[model samples]
Target: MNIFLINPPNCGRSIPEERYGITSLKQIFRGEPLALEELAGNLLEHNVRILDLKADPDGLDRELREFPPDVVGITGVTCEANTVLQLAVKVKEACRAIVVIGGIHASNDPGFFNHAAVDYIVVGIGKKAFADLVCALESDTDASALPGVMRTRPGRALERPPLRNTVADLVVEHSPNYELVSRYRSHYILEKLGITMGFVASAFGCPHRCLFCSIQGQTGGGYLTKPIETVVRDIGLLVDIPVIRLVDANTFGDVKRATALGRALFESGLKRQYLADIRSDTVVRHPEMLRQWQEAGLRAVIIGFEEIDDASLLAMNKANKASMNAEAIAILNDLGITIVGDFIISPDYDEDDFDRLGTYLDTRRIDLPMITVMTPLPGTALYLQEHHRIINHNLDYYTLTNAVTTTKLAEERFYSRYAALLANSHQNARL
Candidate 1:
C-alpha cells in the first residue's frame, strides 16, 4: 500500500492574539512528528512517505497529486483537531485514500473525528494498531474489531476498544523511520539555542493523573517504557542532532528502569544531550537517578510544578506538593542540570495570585519557566469538572494559552496579566 503520513502544520489559534492583539502569546511548534514517523516505521512493507506540513506547509497538495497514496494517516493534538479534519477533507477530495486520524486529540475524543472525512479513529499508542489496520485494509479484511481502533460512525457514539497499550503496542523493535523526515531535519531546531534537536520516545504515557493532563488518553493511564537498548539505538540514529528530547509524559516514571536506562546510556557513550519530563516527586525521591542521568548527558529536566500552593495542587490532583517542587529545583540546580519548569496559571487568579506566582518565580532558580493558562482541555478531569463554565467551544482556541472558561477578572485584563507574567518570567529565561 502506498501510505502518506501527515504531520499537521503549526496550528491552534491564540485568544490573546486574536482578541487582544497579544502576538507574543501565540505558540509556534517546531519538532519532528515522531508519532507519524513511528507509524511509518511499522509500515515498512508499504511505500510510505511522511509529509510534515509543519516543515513544508505548502507541500501537501503537491505530494497528494504526485504520490497519490492508498492510505492517509494524520496525527495532531487537541488544538489541531479541527485542522486535522480539514486536512482529512482535503485528502478525501484529492484522492481515494482511506483517511485515518490518530494522536492525542483523537485518542482522547475518538468520536470527534467520526465525520465523513475520517474513516477510522485510532485511540491509543497507534504504531502496532495502525499497522494492523493498514494490513486489514490492504487485504480487504474487517478492521473494525482491532483493539484501540474505532471505525468512525457519524452522529453515533463510538464503540471504543479496550486499549492494548502493552509493550507490544510500542513496537520498539522497529525504530522510528527517522530518515523519512531527514529533509525536514534542519527545520527541527531548538529555537532558543538554534541547535538541531531530535525526538526519541524512551517511554510513553504517565503514571500520575493530574486533573488537567491529557497524556493518560495515550496509553489508558498506563506507563510503558522501551528497552534501554532500543532507546539508545533511537538516539544513535539521529546521528548529527545534538539534543534529544525524550518526548514522554514522564520519562522517569519507573525509577528502577530509569536508573538502569541512565547507566546503559552512560555505558553506550551515545554522547547526546537529553531533555526529558520528570515529576518533582520523582526528583525528590530519586535524586541519585537524576544524578546518573545528568552524567549520561541529561542536560535539562522539564518538571511540571503546575501550581505554587498545596491547596491548588490537591485540587488539580497533582499528587505532589509545592515543597517537593522547590526541593527538586534545588536538587537539580545543585546537580548542574538545567531546569525547564512548567507552571500553570489559573483563570481564577486575582491580583494577589499573580503577585504571589511572580514572587515565587523570582525566588526560584529555575532555568526556564514555561507558564501557560489553566485550560480545561476536553477529555481531562478538569474539563469534566469545569465544562459547565466553558464559554469557548472552539477547538482552535484550546491552545493551553487560552482560557476556555470565563475568567475571574475581565477577559482583556486576564490576558494582559498573562502576557505580562510571561514577559517577566522570560526576561532571564535559559535552556
Candidate 2:
C-alpha cells in the first residue's frame, strides 16, 4: 500500500508575528512536520512519504501526479480546520485516494471532518490505528472496529471509544522517520538562535488542568512520558540537526522523569543545545532539578506565567500564584537559562493593564515575552463556560492573537495596544 502523509499548509495566525517581530516571523518558526514523520515511521513497511506544504506548496500536485498514493493522511489544528477541509477536497478531486484527517483537532472533534471528502478519521493516538487501517485496506478488510478509527458512511457516523481511551499505550517503539524531511532542513529553523533545528517528543500531554488549555483533555487528564532510552534513540536519529527542540507541551511535567532524561543526555556527551517547556509551579518546586538540566545542555525554557496578577491567575485556575511566577522567573534568571515567558491578555484589559504588563516584563528581565489574547478554544473547560460569549465562530480569529469576545476597551484601542506591546517587546528583545 502506498501511503502519503501531509502537513497541510498553515492558515492560522502566525505565532512569531504576534510575539516576536514580523522581521523574524518566517525565520523563527516554520517547523518540520514531526507528527507526519512519526506516522511515516509506523508505516515503514509500506511505500510511505511526507509532504510539508509550508516547505513546498506546489509539490502537492506534483506528488499526486507522480507518486499516486493509495491513501493520503492529513493532520491539522483547530485554527486550520477550514484549510484542512479544503485540502481534503482538493485531494479527493485530484486523486482517488482515501482521505484521513487526524491530529489534536480531529482527536478532540472528529465530527467536523464527516464530510464527503473525508473517508476516515483517526482520533487520539493515531500511530497504531493508522497503521492498522493501512493494513486492512491492503487486505480489503473492514477497519471500522479498530479503536480510535472512525469511518464516515452515508446516513451513519461510526463511533469509537472516547478519544482519550486510545492513548493508554501510545509510546510506540518506532522512532520518527527523520530522513523523510531531511531535504527541508534549511526551511526549518530557530532564527533567534540562528541554527538548524530538529524536534523530539519526549513526552505527551500535560498534567495540569488549566481551564483555557485543551491539552489535558487530549491526554485523558494524565501525563505520559516516552521512555528515556526511546527519547535518546529518537535524538540520535536526527544527527544531521544541531539543535533538538523537545516539542512536548510540558517537557518537565514529571520532574523526576525529565531529570533522568537530562542526566542520560548529559552522560551521552551530545553537544547539541536543547529547549523545552514546563509549568511555573514546577520551577518553584524543582529549582534544583532545573539547575541540573541547565548543566545538561538545557539552553531555554518556554513557561506559562499565564497572568501576572493574583486575581487573574486564580480566575484561570493556574494553580501557581503571581509570587510563584516571579520566583520562577528569578530562578530561571539565576540559572542563566533563557526564558520564553508566556502571558495572556484578557478582553477586559485596558490601557492601564497593558502598561502594568509592560512594566512587569521589563522588571523581570524576561529574555522573550510571548503574549496572546485569552481565547476559549473548543474541548477546553473555558470553551464550555464561555462558548456563549464567543461572538466569532471563525476559527481563523481564534488564533489567540485575535479577540472573539467583546472587549472592555474599544476594539481599536485594544488592537493598537496589542500592536504597541509587540513593538515594545521587539525593542526590549534587542537588549
Number of colliding residue pairs in each model = 0, 0
Q: How close is candidate 2 to the true structure, as a TM-score?
A: 0.94
lDDT of 2: 0.82
Native RMSD of candidate 1 (Å): 0.8
lDDT of 2 by residue, 153-208 (tens): 63676576534443434636888889898888888987766778899988887877
- CA lDDT, every model vs. true structure: 0.92, 0.82
Model 1 per-residue lDDT at 39: 95
Instruction: Mark the regions of model 2 whose C-alpha exceeds 4 Å error after superposition.
Output: 13-28, 153-158, 162-168
| lDDT (tens digit, per residue) of candidate 1 on 308-343 | 999999999999999999899999999999999999
User: Candidate 1: misplaced stretches above 4 Å?
Assistant: none
Report how far off residue 330 is in candidate 2 (Å): 0.6
What TM-scores do the predictions have? 0.99, 0.94
